[model samples]
Target chain A: MDFLRRLFGGKDNSSSSAQEAKKRLQIVLINDRTDISPQLLENLRAEMIAVLTKYMDIDEPRIEMDRGHDESAVALIANIPVLRIKRGAGGTLEDRFEDNPDDRSEGKFSPRGEPPRNQNIKSRRRK
Target chain B: MGARVIVITSGKGGVGKTTSTANIAVSLAKAGKRVVAVDTDIGLRNLDMVMGLESRVVYNFIDVIEKNCKLNQALVRDKRVENLYLLPAAQTRTKDAVSPTQMSELCDQLRPDFDFVLLDCPAGIEGGFKNAAAGADEALVVTTPEVPAVRDADRIIGMLESMGKSPIRLVINRFRAMMVQNNEMLSQEDILDVLSIKLIGIVPEDDSVIKATNRGEPLTFTQNSPAALAYANIAARILGENVPLLQLDSYHSKGFVASLKKMLGF
Candidate 1:
């Protein structure tokens, strides 16, 4: 298993077996707490990342499974970093700054349907 | 008006549910409250043995429910502790012999007479677990700070909550503080974090506990072991006492461990 992990570039969870058990347990418990499978969660994360990547420069997207309780419903938690937007051709951040200086929306990553999104498209003339 | 039937359960076997039931019952009765500890494991009954009331169990819990004997007739009084009783399970019969509703009704019938009624639940989330959990208004989920145990505890806690059982508290059994401190075992905080339940108490892994069980005595007998003190604290907390949690590592376990085992005749 160690050889396989090293071969596959898999990071070891922990050295101590007890802490390993705890780490494994936390993951297993989260899975057991919800009906959703880890594979499905991974897929969800991937799909969401793909959707977000198309609109903005997202860095270090992470999905965390936080259990509020054993009895309560499971909640999905995600954190995505938006560096900047992928604008139209010749719509680099520098060009946008030159055309509309002090455009707060320029080079900023904004969620779809938000105010900054329209402002971003207006100055860049991107769809 | 009636006593609260709190079922002591662990989804996995050999995690010390019966032991917890016996010690907690003894602690409560010693504190001057009327207590009855029922062994709901049916075929594999051991609570009677743990309470040292095995010989006195003339009529089992099934006998009372089936009308073979009166409820009081089947209840075996503890020899050492006053106001403490044991309702032994029928070792010869299977869990299928008793139904969930029947167990619920039995607890309901015994409620008004005692200050607290405790059920020693069997392992697994099957029929026996359902029957044991049926009558209880509260639950005490027992688990060791291990992977398999915590996983089962999580499932059991989920089931109990879905069943509408209120105030489910966790009791971490057989904890080894040194192992946890060295990161070779899961810490109490880690277990609680994963399980996400209110921690009632933590019983340290003590050598005296094994001796106590072998002698058919509850660990709380000598009050010498950290486990014994832990059980007593759990009982006190159950009574709404403002007892602080025991710091296991600081219990002077170094030299105290040797002296306690010797004094306990282990």
Candidate 2:
């Protein structure tokens, strides 16, 4: 109900009803389409944040995670805005920047070993 | 080599599955195609009444399924339109009375005789739905522009896809154009995006439909009415005609509310 209320901007007008219904349907159908419950999705997001935080400072509140579908398959799309990498937290700066092709091939989200079609990790560099 | 058995179904109740079935059947029949609308609702039969053949229903679908009556004997020929018939469902029997195999057999029997065999499916995704959809080669999923209806429709579409039913088209029934313009109702695009199926019809909310249903007549019997034209368009599309979608009257909001909507980027 909180999401529904937020969807309509706390207005009870007829104009807002459609928006509310659309949002409610889109949210509810994610489970049916992806076979992942919202609770489970939330848990996954939380785990992702926890893991990513170890090597990078991500803007958790601004993280957008949802199931996106293309002609081929449904994919777990995450647009996590990275504030900066934790250079001193885990390893050397050069080690943290190391991008292994093997690691990239093993997708973080794909449970069936199929890499996600799109995994956008936007770096929000703050000056 | 036979009629394409297309099931007109909606998982939710009272979303115009029966209405769409009646109108589309009538339209197809009027277009010189042999069409039969079978009420697969069993105990909740309304297709016969909608087609104005309730009094002439001597036999029902269950009778044919149980071998109590021949398929031809159970078909109620519509006197109003040539090549149109109604296979009424039994009011006394529950949905359990007709098994999926029996329904498929019934469809096969009607296939060679008609150009299109339309099964009016009952609500809910239960045994009744399975029985109705068992014989279907294609599907017409009906839903209103509401949350619950769209959700159930998505579920039905999923089931139909899993069953390998191809060319599954959507019919968004009882659409209020003005409400959609005012952002009071979900738009056609919103629904199609969610359902992710090809759209065949968008029936506008019309009083004529209620009047026709109450009189035991299909709205398609009337000429050029909004809902009638919509149903006729659906029929034409089914026959592989290149008819464009019906254009409903558009509305523009005025004054303070309009400014508010503009401010909200609606």
Candidate 3:
């Protein structure tokens, strides 16, 4: 069924509505799932900087929650810089992605391990 | 056996949730199954207008929940289809007027008499959505080929999953075959891949849908229109029938041409 549609409908309009919708939906859904709205993330980042400055000397802290290939296991990887270590929790947030974020054995988010998403667009534009 | 409670919801507005609820309920009723569609979008109710039962709506759903009227008294039977009915939402009251417990209890009361109870969930994953989804055994999430609707549908599907709803399905509405063929709109496969849920229906973009809404008619009859054909197919699928989706390439042009030739005796 798909083979037939691709053979006929896939010939012209390779940039068809079908492909556009899929790409747009992927980005939009990933963003929604990640729940890192730009405004909200910005406010959190500001607060994190302010609260951290009150405690100790720190470098730039980047809060990035990247959407992995898997739909459910989006990652929230925060790079918090501190000159001194704090005592309390034994394990760290840095090693969280070592295990599967979701129950799926297949690692959901590549955590800077997988290939980038825009390779297709970049190649298409070059052509 | 008790009726199957199915809720039709789309987190985003203007994606044919009410339209699908009305038409599918009518189609099921036309097929001899007793069906009642509940309008849960109180205050911004459109199901009454879409089903063309606005004139007959004396008692809304809130009335029944509030015990102001009997359940049957609030139910408006369709003039065109026997055994098909509507439980309308209140025009003045808000969605908060009805609780999840009340809605589910109402559905339980209607279960023995009907084969299907269709709940029309309001737009957004807020109070109205929870109230409508509360009584449903399954969910039919509606979305268009656009990005925002798909995004919201994904969110709604996640919410449904968290609520432990089984067999969540997708209904792609306002689909343009030409756009899909041209790679301009999202195809069924693309939507399925992104949403990763089972697709139950794919309705084509037809002007007749708007016309039917204006006339308070549902496009679920055996019409030449593609949208009606899709709805009829969906209605059958909902009855647990093993129906395959329309073979697009053949049904789009070749089948029509062949049927036309047969009609002309050429």
Query: DockQ: which candidate is best?
Result: 3
* Interface quality of candidate 3 as DockQ: 0.36
Model 2: native contacts recovered, as a fraction = 0.73
CAPRI-style grade of the A/B interface in model 1? acceptable
How closely does chain A match the true chain A in each prediction, as TM-score?
Answer: 0.36, 0.45, 0.33
- Clash pairs, model 1 backbone: none
Which one wins by DockQ: 1 or 3?
3
lDDT of 3 at B226: 71
TM-score of chain B of each: 0.93, 0.92, 0.93
| Model 3 chain B lDDT-worst window of ten | B257-266
Q: Report how far off residue B38 is in candidate 2 (Å).
A: 0.4
TM-score of chain B of 1: 0.93
TM-scores, all models, native as reference: 0.71, 0.71, 0.73
lDDT of candidate model 3 versus the reference:
0.79
Instruction: Report the lDDT tens digits of candidate 3 across residue range B78-136.
Output: 98889999999999987789889998998999999999999999999889999999999
Candidate 1 vs 3: which has more TM-score:
3
The parts of candidate 3 lying over 4 Å away from their true place are A1-18, A35-75, A78-127, B249-266
- Distance from true location, Cα of B233 in model 3, Å: 0.7
Candidate closest to the true structure, highest TM-score = 3
The TM-score that candidate 1 achieves is 0.71
The list of candidate 2 runs beyond 4 A from truth reads A1-15, A36-127, B247-266
